[model samples]
Every structure is written in structure tokens, then in C-alpha cells.
Target: MIRTPASRRHGFSLVELMVSVVIGLLALLFALRMVGGAEQTRRSALGGSDEMQNGMVALFSLGNDARSAGYGLNDPIIAGCNTQFSDTKGYQLAPATRGTTDVTPLAPVVIEAHGANPDRVTFYAGTSIGGTPTLRLTSDAAAGATQFDVDRIVYGFNQGDVLVVAPEQPGGDCLLVQRSDSDPTATRVTVAADAGMRFNGGTPTATFKGYAARVFDLGPVGSLAFRSWSVADGYLQLQATGPDDASAQPSTVAEDIVSIKAQYGFDTRTGSAFQPQNGLQVNQWSAAMIDADGSGTAGDAADWQHIAAVRLAVVARSKAVERPAAGAACTTTTAQPVVFADAAPVGVAAVPTTVNVAVTGDPVDWRCYRYRAFETVVTLRNAGWRPNP
Candidate 1:
């Protein structure tokens, strides 16, 4: 008989086993909760970064164009109107005249949709370096001549470029034509389309100074960038094309931009010094501040020329929806407007500030979302180049 040593099998009691299993499960649940919290924080940080980046890009694009508004045009005054060439409704392949007038009553900047959820702003600018962008003529250009000779041919000029020939004396001898040549080395460019414009009716004037005739390239026919910025469907959009291009569509510049506010910076001081009579260092900016002729009256189109800078603000929101604490409500108590430090509108009740914008087309509560605001002042370098008439 095998001596069966009583097996000292002290197996765990059922109560002991059950208690141990319960403790293990509790530890696992706690670990999962910690991981979930960390992931939420990461998502929030990433979303915030994206919103800020979008806002910055929007501001940069707008500022770049605003600073160069009057680039190549010799005229110090910038006038906004329906250009003569654009009246036919297409991209301006040729030079155009101001729809409003030859002089005075010009607007380089136009604001639309004021006091609304999304505002629209339009501005005009040239790509030329500065005054005296003309090249001397090498030979005489006959009436309806497809091409003309120029002493200097600059690089970067492409086919479909627009050329302007204006009299140095500021008389009525102006010719606007479109380039049909793609050759960069060629001494002459042909004009396939005139857009019904002529310089002295193709007759060379002895008063005009050049080998044959003096001319200048106002960038490419397609280079005339007529851009419009607006907030639509929760996105900041940019519509850039020839102002006449009805077929052109707007492109998305940035996302989650809900609202925009802007103010025009004006120099209302009457004396030689920069200080205004109001005792302010700079005349406070306002959406309604106007001083076209500095006659003490406001609202004239010429007032736009005095706009030295633009005080702009943009408000962005998160793409994701968040919830309150487990038991907390989804309501938000404070919705503050964006404050502008440089703006001080005169006689106006208040400066136009960005406010809480409503989000639509969603089942989730918008109050649970987060928002960010960005503000900056963009100086118009071209505006300063123009002398006050």
C-alpha cells in the first residue's frame, strides 16, 4: 500500500477567490478612466492649435494685399469702382478706367454686410513697384498695330499681360492693351485684344517722350488680383480673380472663422503735427469716421484715401463639440466681444467688436464649445505713398 501522504492541499476558499477577483477589476476600471482623460486633453490642444493657425493665415493674406494696394499705378489716389473693361463681365485682359470718375470720388476699399454675422471687404491694389514703371518706345506703333517696340523688356511678363501707355504730361493720351506673346526675350509683345481702348487713337504725339512711345506693364492681364474676403458657412473664404470674372468662384482660406470686424484708421488732425484737436495722439479709428476733403464733413468717397491702416479682428471656434461635467448643464453664461486696443471711434456709440456667433445645423449644443479671438492692425503702405490733394 503506497503511503498516501495526506496531500496538504489548502486550496483558496471561495470567499477569498471572489474578493481577489473584485480588487483586480477595480484597478482595471481606474486605469481606463485615466487613459480616457488624457486622450481628451490631447484632442483639445490639437484643435486649439489648428484654429489659431487658420486665423493667422487669413490675416496674413489680407494684409499682404492691403499693403500693396497702389503698387504700380502712378496715381497717389486709389479709386474703387466698376472698371470700364470689367463692365462687359469677364476677367480684365486690358486696362480699365474707374467707373465712378477720372478723378475724385474714388474708393479703394469697400465694406459690405455691415453689422451682420459675416462682413465682406473688398480692396484694389496694383503689383507695380512704384511711380515711373514705364519703358521707352523703340519705334512708332501704327494704329491697330499688333505689336510695338520697347527699349527695355522686363522679365516675369507673360502672355495675356496688360500694358498701359499714358502721357507723361497727364493729358488724355492713354492706351490699354493685352499682351499676346509668351516670349520673355522678345523685344515686343503683340496685343490680340484692345478692349476698345487706344492711346491717342494710335497716333504718336510729339510731346510724348520715348524712342517711339513710352509704355508700362501693369502686371499680367491675369495679375490684377481682385480679392474679396468673407465668412461663409463657418469658413473664411477668399474670392480672387479678375473682378469681372463672374465665373470664378471663391476658395477657402481658413476654417472655423465665425465672425470678423474691421475699422478704418484715419488722420483727422488739421494741423501740421500728427496730434488731433481732440487731444488724442492719433485720431481714433471708426467704421463711420470720414474726412475726404478734411473740410470737417465726412462720408465722401475721397475719405477712403485717408485710411492709413485697418484694425481687424477674427473669431474662431472649435470643430469638435464638448460636454460639461457629468452632471453640469450645457449653458454658457458669458459671451464677450473682442476688445480692440488701437480703435477709438469718435462720435460713435461703440466700436464694432466681434461677438459670440451662433452655430447652426447641429444637434449638439454650441454653448459647450470653445472659441478664440485674434486681433491686429495692418498698415497700408501704399496709402501713405499717396499725397493728400
Candidate 2:
């Protein structure tokens, strides 16, 4: 309120005050932007990392098991992986089984007798769960139906079943399963629980398991997806369902999965390419070869047993961890075609698709980064493993 000449002169000039205010605002905006960018980078990195790790776990883990696909269960080891279990209609022969006094690993075979008829020899996988299946002979599925299950005896696999973390429920439970006799002790079990079974009252003679199992083929020319070992003729099969409360399908957590891509592998050196028993030529490289058909003729193809390497890829999509635009919608389509050649003579016309969604998941929080890409090589190593046939 003073009107003294000295007081008036001391007051700040209009331009000086305006400049100071502008400077302060500019600093505040710059700090905010830096903080925001750092957060975004972290989120992106996190999403990528999560997907990469998941993919590695899937490929490497399976590769480790497949390397042992067929070991000590075939003649000349690698060569016998393609041997047929049986050609009879009455019943399929046993898979991996305890070797008889007369049987030797050199001539690994499961002989089944139809009473007076001579015993039939079949190749299979044998696994060890509660107790190690030293030498398991391949046996048929349930008496009435043709479905693989944890039973006293199996028809296709011997002791070579795979044991690893499940694709759907990794690190959840543990189990002992069976694959083909030719398979090593690699892809049989499907448990992440502590090794060994629980003998509460008494451990069930068998346990449920699914390892390195995948949608092998979608029939010769149908959209119907089948497991690697599915054979309409042999009839013994397993079905994989979508997310569910029960075990068959778990991990409904959307963001948990980033991306999944699969291709068939074959014996390239064979000239004929790696073809399964059913006579389907495989095109891509693979860590392990499936029987193709329940006919159980993996080891039979010397080329397959000789395979050396495989090609694998995994890509996952997570929600933007901190998308400035939260309510943003993502565009997804099933038409995103994945064309996989039919291996040889006849190829699939239309490209089969995996999945597509429009924002069902969200990105992770900022701070940590998630690697996005995962690529690897799986070499065969086991009692009787081969990558180049």
C-alpha cells in the first residue's frame, strides 16, 4: 500500500515475472515426460521377456525329452524308431515293456500272444514315475475304447515316455506317462510337482501324464487337429481342449501366453524326407519325430532317427503394460493364415490358423522388461537318438 518512490522501483518488471513462470512450467513438463517414457520402455521390455522365456521353456524342455525319443528299445537303436508295433487287427501289441529273459535291448520288442497265435512284437516307450519302469512293453489303451491313459500296461510306449513341465500347466503337478518304445525317457511325464508320487493310502498303480504332446496333424486333409500320435486306424488318441478348470486345459491367464507357432520336422537326408508310418512326408526340421500315426512306426524310419536339428519359434502378445490409451481396442483376425506344406506329394491348400484376439489381455507393469523373441536349436542325445537320418 505504500506509495514511496523506493518501493515502486523495487517491484519486479512484468516481463521478468512472466519469464520465471514459463521456465518453471517447462521444467515440470520435461520431468513428467522422462518418467513416462522410462515406464513405457520397461513395460515393453517386460512383455517381450515373458514371451521369450515361455517359448524357451517349451522348446528346450521338449527338446531335452525328444532327444531321447527312442533309446535301447530298438534294434540298432536309431534305426528301429520307425519299426511298426503291429499290423494285426485283433489287437495292438505292447509298447515299451520289461525285457524278457530272452529279450535284449538290441532286439527291443513287446510280444503279445492271441492264445495259440505266436506273440506279436511292438515298439513303445516306458517311463518311470513312482517307480522306474526299467523295461516297459507297449500295451493297448483301455479295453473297450482306443484312448491313451495311465494304466497298468500301454500298447504304444515302453519306458521312453517324456517327463517335463506341461505346456498348459507348467510347474504345477508331476506324473509318469508313456510315449513310443523308440522314444527316450524324455517326453512322457507331464508334472512339475515335486518328483515322485504321493503314496497317501497307496499310490495309484498309474498316473496321468502329457509331455511334449502337440497337435501333430489335422488329419490327411481335414481341419480336425490331431495329436502327434493320432491314427484313425490305430484309434488310440488324446484330445487337447481349450482353457478349463480341469487339467486337460489350464492356464486361462491370457497374458501368460504371448505367441505359439509350430512346424513338422522330418529326415531330410533320407531323400524321401522324414515321413511317418502313415506315409506323410515331413517338411520342416524338428527336435523330435512323432510316430505320425498310432501305427507306432517312429524308429522304423532310419532317416527320422538320424535327424540332427529342428526349427522352432514362439511369439506372444501381451496387453500394453501402460498403454496411455487404456481402453484402446486391438485388432485381431483368424484369417491370419499359417501355411504349412504337406511335406511332399500332396500339400495342404489352405493355411491352418492358430488364434487371434482383440485385446483379451493387458501388458505388464513398468520397471522390468519382458523379452519378446525366442528361437533355439535342439540336438538329439540319448540311449538311441539321431537327428540326421
Candidate 3:
């Protein structure tokens, strides 16, 4: 082979070759770093979006149910009665308790507070075509009676309409019955134990009986809503009761919801004695309904009637699992998320409340993820329309 001149050399020496190799390796390393950083940034952005979307869904579901609370059950005579209801298909209303007594009060909204843990909210409403009118019973309805004789002709009630037979007294057990047969021109609405009926069997007639009983129509079974909301297994869920949803299984409303906190907004004045105030404005908020009427029992009808609105807060977490560098500890979540930031007390001075979100019990380390909180105050419109008893 002919020897090439130094200036026109075709091949590089070993030193030049090594230097070229070093430069190529540096360029490759730099490109890899850029790609890695971009991936991390993308993950964070997507995670934040997911968190926000989930939180909004949870807030909307809770607010929607709360808005319709106490629709047909807003009557002062039956609004806060401990309703005795049952479904043959294993459906039962949300179990509420005051002290040691188990009760299920008929209200537009009931909040079961669990300190530091997620709270449970139950909503009740009727979708009757006609307005909620408490029809007087023409005669006494003996225990276990299948038919109810009303003062006026039952025109708007359908065959599957759910009716609540409430005693004239304010604090009594209300019975839920289904209208199996109804004639538009007749005053007798039958709640017979038909095979297709779901809420007529388990409730004993002795559970409700009186000449002063009033019938409140809850519309058709398909339109009746008795839904309860809670956070469980890292998801927001709704447990609804009706003919179609007799299973009573809680369906997931949103994912990554780690906590739910709620409080009852009362329409009372600022004083030692909780005096009723004018208008539908919320004067005070409490985690639980106390014996506002000095009735000796907490969460009684007297306490529930004061509830004018519900303040709800939901917490959501990111799905992305961040990794620590080498042996470093997780620094993604420096502190727990705060909720109800603007929730200062109104009227009187009260202790500020803080909720501790328990997000560490899951299989994966929750510290590697970020969190967001959504809050709303839903007014009970039906409560506003009803005059305080």
C-alpha cells in the first residue's frame, strides 16, 4: 500500500481515536439525561391532572345528592323521624346511631362523623310528580294494614310509588311502604305485600300505627333516591337504595379519593343556646348534630331540623409512584395535604378543625405521591322551603 501523507491521512491514530470515543460517549450521556428529565416532568403533569379530575368528580357527586336531600321528607312532622324501612332484597337505609341507640332518621342529609377518618354522608329525597303533600289519613291505620285511606283521591301516585306513613307527632318512627295498587279516582291506596314489591315485607305493621298518621308520597320506585356516600379502599363510593338497586353494594364514584370530611351547617344564631335564625343563611357548623332543642338525646329530630346545608371536603392522591434517588428517602410529599383552608368559624369563636388524612396504610408508600383537596358547601334547598317547627 502507498503511504499517505501526514496532512492527507485517511485513518486516525490511537490517541485521536480515544478522544473521539470519549466525545461520542459524552454526547450519548447528555441525550439520555435530557430524555430522563422529560419523562419525569411528563409523569408529574399527568399525575396532577388525574388528581384534579378525580377530585372534581367526587365533589360533583356529593353536591348533587346533597342538593336534593329531604325532597319529600322535608315535612316538619316527619323530617327527622327515625325511619323504619326495609327491603326484602337485602337493602336497608344508612344505619345511624346516637350514643348506643341505632337509628335511621329521615332527613335531607345526615352526616356520620369519624374523627381523623373519612366521614359518611347519607341523602334522602323523593321524585314525586306532584309536590310533597302530607295527606291526612281518613281513618286509623291499624298495625299491619295493607291499605291507607287518604282524605283526597290519589291522582298522581303510581303503582310503585313509595309512601311514608308518619305519625302526627314530630319524633316517631316513620314506616316506608310501597303502593302496589292505586286507582286515580279512589282514596284507598294499597301497599299490599306483592311479590314484586321490595319495601313492604320486612317492616312489621306494629312498627307504624295510628289514626293521625299522614301519607307522604315518594314517587315511583325508580325515581326515589336514598344514597349514602363514603370513602373506602382509596375510592369514593355511593350506596343507593331502590327497587333496581336492591343489592345495596357501594359503587365506586371516583378513584384515588383518600379522605372525605363533612360538617352540618346549621341555621342558628350565635349564642350559648342554639336559637333558630331567619332566612336560609348558615350561622354555624358542627361535625355532629347535638341535642339542640334540649331534648336530652343527641341527633334527634330536633337536632336534624337545624341542618341547613352540608360542607364537604374530598382528598385525592396522584397515581404516579415516584422513586427516590439511590438511598435517599421519599421527598415528593413533604407534608400532608390541608383541607377546608377557608373554613373559619362563623358567629362565635370556636376551635379550628383539622383532618388527618390516613394515606400510608396502602401497599405502596403514599409518600411517593402528591395529593389535592376539593371542598364545597351544598345548601339544602328543600330545608329552606320548609318552615322550622
Candidate 4:
């Protein structure tokens, strides 16, 4: 077939061309599939990261608040004063569970005289507006206007500061307030939040920070009850009531335990050699409480100067988070949250730990202590306790 080369040109047949087209289409489809799969993987990874970060933040918040639990009238007031309300109120509400009206009283630690007022907040029965609970404050806690209006203003401020609840100043719309211990109200000795100011208002009028203090002076359960006091064994001990029940009685609530811890300060050893278990010895307490120098309880409650410092610790933890399961890849791995008490290092603050039990119905998530377990010794010798000199 050696015909003239130009005349005998050879090329692909129609069938062959169609077959090529099909092959090309198949390759394109495979590439697209790969790209879609990659995008999906990236989205999944990002979602996991967000979940972990959110869980961490929630846990930290729970820890901070829980740590401050049980810091009674004499506990360390790291932020505010331990003012015993003479006869006033701060926060009153029908708690999630309770029996009496919760109240926060005024303390001698007057923070102000005539500057600003606290915002009075009241939440009660109301119409469901926009699918939400609706309630307004009819009484202004701190209005300073000429005609002081509103009836009784209830209040529950921080646990250790002087918060006053009184009638809006006679004529002014704003109410008179004091926070420090040096209040000038000798006759009245009352601190009043105008119920007309914000919590973080620029002036001394503000008391509560991110969250308001629970100052209920009632039984084990009260809305205003931040912490409760009871005599266990002739010892004045306190515990968190409403928000600080960490033992998980009945059934555990969301991070049901925020924080809880305690400290003990004793006076110098008076009669005999001290034993770590018998409790604090403050009979003839030394200048410093807790027997940092081995003394007894030298201070008295009547005068702020009578007693020395005491023990204090705060326990906190976040509400429990939803748990996920482990798979075949996690065969030999343990499944549980590891707490400090469990082979954890000291000062180790962490969230729930997960081990792979791979069992049918055991909890994979473990709860950390509501309160970071630590104790701090305080000395009220010259300041909070009686004359130690």
C-alpha cells in the first residue's frame, strides 16, 4: 500500500474519538470529588476547635466565681469590704428554689455619702412579650430627683462591701450610698443603693461586678443566699446554698458547683501543744491568727479589731458538657475526666478529662473540682482582729 503519502492520510475513527471524550469526563469528575471532600474535612476541623475553646471559657468562668464561695463576714474581701448590713436590703427575688425573702444588708464600710445610686432591678410576673419573660422595676433604688419616689427598694450586693438600700434622698432623684467601712451615718448607719444606677456606674455607687453578690440571711435555700452559715461541731462553718452546692445531691445541675473552699486562721497556742486535727486554737491568740506564730483566738466579733484572720478557699467548676464517644482507634485508652486528686500535678487547673472506657453506659467525661483546692492564711492581727500588740 505504498500509495502517495499525502493521499493516504490516517486519523482516529469516530468511535475512537467518542471513547476519548468519555475518559476525559471521568477524570474531571474524580478531581471534583476530591476537592469537595477536602473542603468538608476543613470545616469539620474548625468546628471541633470552636467547641473546645467555648468549653474552656465556660469552665474558667465557673471556677472564678466558685472559688469565692463561703468567704463569710470575716473571710478575705479581696475586692470589697465585709460590711454587715445594719438593716437594709440589696437583692430580693423568688429563687429557682427557696422558702424566704433573700436580703443583703448594709455594712459600716461606707463607700460614699452623696455621689451616685445603684440600679434597682425587679423581676416578677408579667406578660410573655416576644416569647420572653417581661418584668420592670416600679421602684427606683437610687433616684435623686426632687420628689423621692418609689416604695421599698430591696438589694443584695457583693458579699463583703457596704451596700445601702434606702429611700431616694429626700428631694434629689439620686439616692445616698456608702461602700467603705468608714461610713459617716452614725445615727442611721444605713447604706442605700438608689436602685437608679448601673452596677458598674463610674462612681462609688456601683457594687456588683460581672455578677451580683448573694447576701441572703436566711435558711439553707434563699435567692439572696450566696452562702449559708451553720454550726457543725461548735465551729462556725459556712457553705454555699443556692449556687454553691457542689456535692451533687439528688442530681447534679449544670456545673451545679461553681466553686467552694475554706481556710482556718488560729491564735497563738495557749494551753497545750497544738495538734493539726483538733481545730483552730484562738483562746489567747497571738498578734496573728492561725497560729502562724502558734497562738489562739484573741479577737472578738463586737469590735472588728477583736479577732484575727481565718482560713479561706474557693471551689469552682463549670456545668457538665455533653460527652462524645471513642472508637476502635482508641482501644487501650482510658475514658474519664482526671482531677488533681487523681495523679494530677499541683496548681493544675484543667477542664473535664475524657478516657476511653468504651463501655456501654459509663460516663466518659469526668468533673473537675468546683473549687480549686488551695488554702491561704490571712492575718487580721492589727486591722481585722483585736489589738495584737
Go through the candidates in order and give each one's C-alpha lDDT. 0.56, 0.30, 0.78, 0.27
Best by lDDT, which number? Answer: 3
Instruction: Give the alpha carbon lDDT tens digit for every residue of 123-164 in model 3.
Output: 899988688656778787667788888888888877888889
lDDT for 16 in candidate 3 is 90
lDDT of 1 at 198: 25
Total clashing residue pairs per candidate? Answer: 2, 81, 2, 85
Assess candidate 1 and give its lDDT.
0.56
Write down the worst ten-residue block by lDDT for model 1. Answer: 78-87
lDDT tens digits by residue: candidate 1, 1-389: 75644553567778889999999899899998899888778777877787788778777777776666545542421232112232133322222222223321223444553564666766565554334255666766654566677776645555655566544342234455556667788777676544532211333332334464556666654556556677877788776555344334567778888777666767655545532222322355675445633655454433554566666678787765666788877654246545464334434233555565665665666576677777776766655554333
All candidates in order of lDDT, best leading = 3, 1, 2, 4
Candidate with the greatest TM-score versus the true structure: 3
For candidate 4, which ten residues in a row score worst on lDDT?
110-119
Off by over 4 Å in 4: 1-11, 72-187, 192-389
**TM-score, every prediction:** 0.65, 0.39, 0.89, 0.30
Question: Which residue ranges in model 2 land beyond 4 Å of their true spot?
Answer: 1-4, 7-10, 13-15, 48-51, 71-125, 128-255, 268-310, 317-371, 379-389
Model 4, global lDDT: 0.27
Query: Alpha-carbon error at 191 in model 2, in Å?
Result: 24
Task: Please give the ranking of all candidate structures by TM-score, highest first, separated by commas.
Answer: 3, 1, 2, 4
TM-score: the better of candidates 3 and 4: 3
